[model samples]
Target: CVGGSNGGVKIEVVDQGIGIPQDDLPRIFEEFVQLEEADQRGTGLGLPISRRLAKLLGGTLEAESLPGVGSTFCLSLPAAHPTG
Candidate 1:
């Protein structure tokens, strides 16, 4: 994780598995949406729920991917300051 300009922190989750397709990237965070190759049993609610939780915490979650290469999911949140 790295510090953001606004006194927040950015955490990145990177994966080297098959990357997401450009066409499907936009909907990846939607509820009940899953990639064609994803496990058939998956409910596809994880990402959407995660994004909602991030927003509730005054943070943001985003993703970047390259087909056949890899993907990265980033979560940025406000940093906590220690009290004296």
Candidate 2:
């Protein structure tokens, strides 16, 4: 889902699966960081790389999760207005 904000737009990607632990949330975006319970096959570089790219484009990336519920990855970016 997507929504408008004061200075930007919020884009959310929500999932319905085993949620991430509270303790692991902080490092979820770090290089090679992955929870054992999650996909062990993953190299865990995706999130960190994505975050860096977002920042380079003048945006922010974040995640929120609830145990056994689900997780949501949010990306906020400034709105682009066309100019004549």
Candidate-wise lDDT, in order: 0.86, 0.84
Predicted structure 1: lDDT: 0.86
TM-scores of the candidates are 0.81, 0.80
Q: Quick one: how many clashes does candidate 2 have?
A: 0
Q: Model 1 clash pairs?
A: none
In model 2, which runs have C-alpha deviations exceeding 4 angstroms?
1-3, 37-40, 81-84
Tens-digit per-residue lDDT, 48-72, candidate 2: 9999987887788989999899999
Clash totals in order? 0, 0
